[model samples]
Target: MSETYHIPVLRDACLEGLNIRPDGTYVDVTFGGGGHSKALLERLDNKGRLYAFDQDAAAAEQAQKLATYPQFQFIQANFRYIGKFLRLHGVRQVDGILADLGVSSHQFDTAERGFSIRADAPLDMRMDTAAPLTAAEVLRTYSEAELHRILGMYGEVRNAKTLANALVRARQQAPIATVAQLKAVLEKHAPKHREFKYFAQVFQALRIVVNEEMGVLEEFLGQCASLIRPGGRLVVLSYHSLEDRPVKNLIQKGVLFGEPEKDVYGNFYKPFEALHRKPIEADETELAANPRARSAKLRVAVRTEDGVR
Candidate 1:
């Protein structure tokens, strides 16, 4: 695991949530630089199998280092296809699944990837470089209304409508082909003291759309309900509310969008039980070391027998 690639947020808490058994099988659905996977491998016995997934080409290089472990298998694919990939490996059920969602530090630090507000690069923010849709394409193709919705919902930008209008107007004059152009066009609208923060939100919104993060998260969480054993655990670390909200609802209420409907007994028909009443955040020490951990929210859920039935 490359320390510079990404530091696993809430590592101790995530491992505790897993309640790892010496011989149990587990999956790390977002391998990134294999930080969490390597940590999991340390806790597992020789018989305990660990499967990891990542679609990024760069992550494939990191995955190769973990190939030395006999109990480890690395699948180069998006975690949304976790069930199919695991089934292909003859793993029908796993004791635990861990997903550290959102973009990795390596992705942001790489200038060519265009995932950072601080970097001036091509408007391409695909987690999988092989992915077809680029941020440039989204900016050029999406309607004003589409931009408004994504900026508001995914980025939580304060003036999404104004920003959307500004983007549309700027693109009409000349294509917004780079991060520098984007920042230049929207600079006037940014708050006087927090220009970089505003740019960060805009870039985040673009990255989410380019990566299809929300849709993939919904698909992955649905599979977790069925793939985990009755007593198994599902631990997720998400970077924003857009990702965390659905995870919370799915774990607590078994529904993606809202409160689950209750039966006459007033018990909600849910697949898993939330291990924590509220999402966990990183400690002050961790926050001081890695400011990125400040936005991270960790949630743990235990699959129930009722879900399997």
Candidate 2:
């Protein structure tokens, strides 16, 4: 894998969170540039097995470099189906699972992928290139209310309703098929000095919806409790609150949303125990080295014996 493909954020911290065992089986669900997987292989002996997944074709190409390692295997699919894919390989349970969520640097840098607000490319932000939905399609087909909800919930955009109306109005005149066209529509509604941030928020919302990111994350998290062996680790590095909230809730409450279910004994039936009371943030050194790490939050949890089915 080319170093420029991605610089793994909080590399050491993530490895520590995984608490890797030399001969144990592991999975890196977001094998973006294989930076994390490569590092993981270095710590494992021949008996250690690592299964990595990525839907991006570019990432699959990077995974090819690690193909020579007998301990490493790459699956070209979304991590939402982690359990099913692992099961297909006869891996009923694993010792550790590491998820590094959000867009990779390579995606953003490659303007044609349309993940960056800085670029003026076709509004195609599907993480899995083969997926039917794209940012432009979402803008074209979604109802104003649907757009409003996604913007407000996913992007947390303050003027989501107003912006949604603007998009509806603008699209009537011309198709908002590219980043430049979308920005033109947004510029009129964006806060004066915060236009860039506003654009990012809008873009983020579109990307999330286009890729069904939150839904995918929820499914993957739900599977984690069952797919990991007791005492195994679940280490997730989430870039935004939308991604982090469910992870935090699952580790602390054992449910993605709302209150945890109670047993007959009146104790909550939680599957995992958090390793740290608070999620770990990038240190100043790492932040300095990779500005993208600024928003990264690392949370680690260990599967408990209590809820084993």
Candidate 3:
């Protein structure tokens, strides 16, 4: 595994949550750097199989190293199509699924990928390079209203309206094709002592929109609910509330949006049982070593054999 690709957060917690059976099939939906996948494989015996998914070319290149392991198979595709891909591979259900939702550390460290605020790279934040829309395209083509909505909803940017207007106004004179260009435009509106945080939020908003992260996450979670067998586990590690909220709701309530329906007896039906009432966070030891783990929230659930309410 490439040390720079990504460091799995809450490794032990996630493994414990999965409760792996020695010979059961498992899937690591976000196989960045294969850290989690490697660990999962270590726990599985010869009869066990591990399927890993990734869309980024860089991650795919890195995954080739794991190919020598007979128990391992790598699928180069976005996890949003996990169900389709699994069915194509002759898999109907899995014993466990693990998703580490952080954009890989390597993606941020490689300046040209444009996932970092500290870099001066071209505004391209597509996790899947083949994807049609890039961050530059989103900024250039999206309307002021669209920009504002994404910034507000995805990034929680405080002055999304002002920032959106500023971006539109700046683009009128010249294209905002690079991080440096976008930073300059936002500098004028950034609050005192909060410029870094503001830039981070803006970039996050653009990346989310360009990647359609929220929609993809919803689809993946929906598939997880259906594809995990009874007593199987669904383990997710989300780096932001935008991602964590849906995972938490879907696992506990069986619905991605709105409240879960209740029976005449006033009891709500749950498809999975939450293993941990509160999300597991990185310990101080891990946090000190990996600052990225600070924002991570790990949630786990086990599929149940209950009837509808």
Candidate 4:
């Protein structure tokens, strides 16, 4: 098997934000390559516990070489069911939660995964390879209107209408199969830049759909409110502005779904304490080392007695 390198982004920031307790329980909700988990484990004593969740089984293969430790447990499941997975492990609340959201370098670099537009892979962009839906299925099955809306909203492509129409017309002639095939069909729809922001957005949208990313994130965030202990930190790194916007609003306002409420004492009851008003970005050094950190926006919040402030 080929070794896949999964570089954890904002490593220092995430570790600092976690404020890890040596003997405290922690959860790595998106344990892509065990980068953060290894760091967390190194800080913990034998008594300290760490649980990791990843729907993709392939994501866990990297850390199999670690010495057997009772304190560390890796679960093969979606982070969306964090609550359920933790329950099975006999865990109720955790001291910290780390979520590194976005496609892992391993996934993008692997041609078979169909995440990178540069690779001539199949149109199967499921982060969790076991996931039922693939990009090809969506492209071939979804109505042109649905495709247009996905590109417009999720991808934020300016020429979504033209692109969707092109895709629809192309599919009628021949079913889209590989990345290069799809690229060829939509070449006219993309901007002057071939491998720049234009195609990135389009690929992002397809990955989001294949993985059901936004929905999973919403579910996972809501679970964090209940899964984290008071004072436990919730740290997330989102790559897309669309993904970061919701996290920012949810962390600061503490109200994700409904209007905010205030008690008679004029003190609002919030579930979490927003660590910073704005999301943090990668520093110059980290960015230079890893261009993936360029789009990273890190958000940190502490769980409060009441939901996120």
TM-score of 3: 0.97
lDDT of 1 by residue, 1-309 (tens): 778988888988999999999899999999998888898899888999999999999998999998888889999999999999999999999999999998888998999999988879999999999999999999999999999999998888999999999999999999999989998987989989999888888888999999999999999988887899999999999987789889988887799997777777777768898898889999999999889999999999999988521
Look at candidate 1 and tell me the lDDT of residue 309.
Answer: 16
Residue 96 lDDT, candidate 3, scale 0-100: 96
Instruction: Please give each candidate's TM-score.
Output: 0.96, 0.98, 0.97, 0.94
lDDT of 1: 0.91
lDDT of each: 0.91, 0.94, 0.90, 0.84
Who wins the TM-score comparison?
2
10 residues in a row with least lDDT, candidate 4: 1-10
How would you encode candidate 4's per-residue C-alpha lDDT over 100-184 as one tens digit per residue? 9988888888899899988798999998877789999988999999999999999999889999999999999998978988888
How are the candidates ranked when ordered by lDDT, highest leading?
A: 2, 1, 3, 4
Give the alpha carbon lDDT tens digit for every residue of 146-173 in model 3.
Answer: 9999989988988999889999999999
Local lDDT at 192 for model 3: 95
lDDT for 253 in candidate 4 is 64
Per-residue lDDT, model 1, residue 38, is 91
Q: Name the lDDT value of residue 276 in candidate 1.
A: 88
Q: What's model 2's lDDT at 141?
A: 99
- How would the candidate models be sorted by TM-score, starting from the highest? 2, 3, 1, 4
